[model samples]
Target: MSRSIDINKRTELKRLLLTLDVKAIPLWGKMTPRQMVEHLVDQVQWTNGKKTATCDRPAEEAERARQLMIYTDRDIPRNIFLEDLPDEYLYPDMETAINQLMTELDDFDEYFKKPGRIAIHGGFGPMNYDEWLIWHGKHFGHHLMQFALM
Candidate 1:
């Protein structure tokens, strides 16, 4: 299980992300700011709704899911697929990218305040909010790292 990110920490994270100067990273492959935003937007929309895409194997696959959940906590690999958005991907520019990120984080923050014991994660079965939080913290943090922002 993961811990949910508190609002304070989330706020600080947003502050940090908003200040990033993406152009500074010279070798983040060919992924443009539009591509990055689009990829991330797709992911957030997927989780918040039903526009599903590739996901880690579900908990029904038990052992593999466990292994991947463990890995999700660690460093995101180089050549991250999110940074390799396809030519067909649609994305807003840098300014809108940052705004959309902020919007989603705020929405998640509000969602966290509602009480529950378990959340049906994409692959990890029903997890308490705290569990989901730890996972989200790592997940979002990894991307922030990818953007050279956190």
Candidate 2:
């Protein structure tokens, strides 16, 4: 299992993002480098209350489901597809996308310093700030490996 995204992990994530070049190709996934960054940005925005997801279950049940998904050592199953993204495309270039994602990461980190409920994750249900950090950290690591950064 991955470490949760605290200040140190957030720094590590930013460093990993910096390692990607504009032309970097995924070793496994369908998204380009820029698109991957965009997807990450969307995730951070969701965590920071800038976006929302409709819950498919009641809050308690959803959180229970999330606990089941996250408490193990297994990698999150591969090739999971997301539906109903907010934009057709978000950033036009890798540099732009990376910059936006960095800003969102900063925002997410700041949000974590306070104790509060985070935005609902589409599949994971309601989350507190710490839970968001764990989920995002795991998700980020998964994508980094998809691009062979891990």
Candidate 3:
């Protein structure tokens, strides 16, 4: 079974991220290292309710994807893209982007402290805190691999 890096391991995540620089190129995707950091920041913000996006998939499809992706120990497929997400980088530099991603991760933990809190995911529809954590772990691991950081 494929296992994802634990998103709760902030120190380890930061250490890995610090190894990345703006010049690093992806092995399989279009996003630069800086853009990837910003993308993660955006995703973390969305999951924590700091940003919002509507579910684009049908309810049944979303549920099926949510079940397969969250429950199974499968790694996210390479080069997957969400059409609604921006391709351009958002932060001024890689450092700012990484800092923002870390901040959002911190917020993610705090936001889910409330009981029964849930957030909408574009592809997976509504997700609870645990589901989001698993999703982030997979998502981060995928990107980290894309850049050969893992």
* TM-scores for every predicted model: 0.61, 0.81, 0.91
Please give the CA lDDT of all the candidate structures: 0.55, 0.73, 0.86
lDDT of 2 by residue, 1-150 (tens): 653344346567777778987687777757877778788888789876677777887777877778876665456667777654444567767767877888887887777677665677777777777666667777887888878887
* Model 2 clashes, total count: 0
Which residue runs does candidate 3 get wrong by more than 4 Å? 84-88
Error of 2 at 92 (Å): 3.9
Rank order (by TM-score, best first): 3, 2, 1
lDDT of 1 by residue, 1-150 (tens): 332233247567657656766565624555554555555555555444334334365556844664566445444455655334587634345667756766765655556576662335555655555555566666665556566654
Which rank order by lDDT, best down to worst? 3, 2, 1
Which portions of model 1 show Cα errors greater than 4 Å?
Answer: 1-8, 26-30, 49-64, 67-73, 80-91, 112-114, 117-121
How do the residues 1-150 of candidate 3 rate in per-residue lDDT, one tens digit apiece?
Answer: 654789899999988998996788789978888878888887898877788879989999999999999999888888777644466667877877888888999999999999998999888999999988889988998999999998
Lowest-sum lDDT 10-residue window in model 2 = 1-10
Instruction: Name the candidate, 2 or 3, with the larger TM-score value.
Output: 3
At residue 65, candidate 3 shows an lDDT of: 94
What is the lDDT, from 0 to 100, of the residue 28 in candidate 1? 50
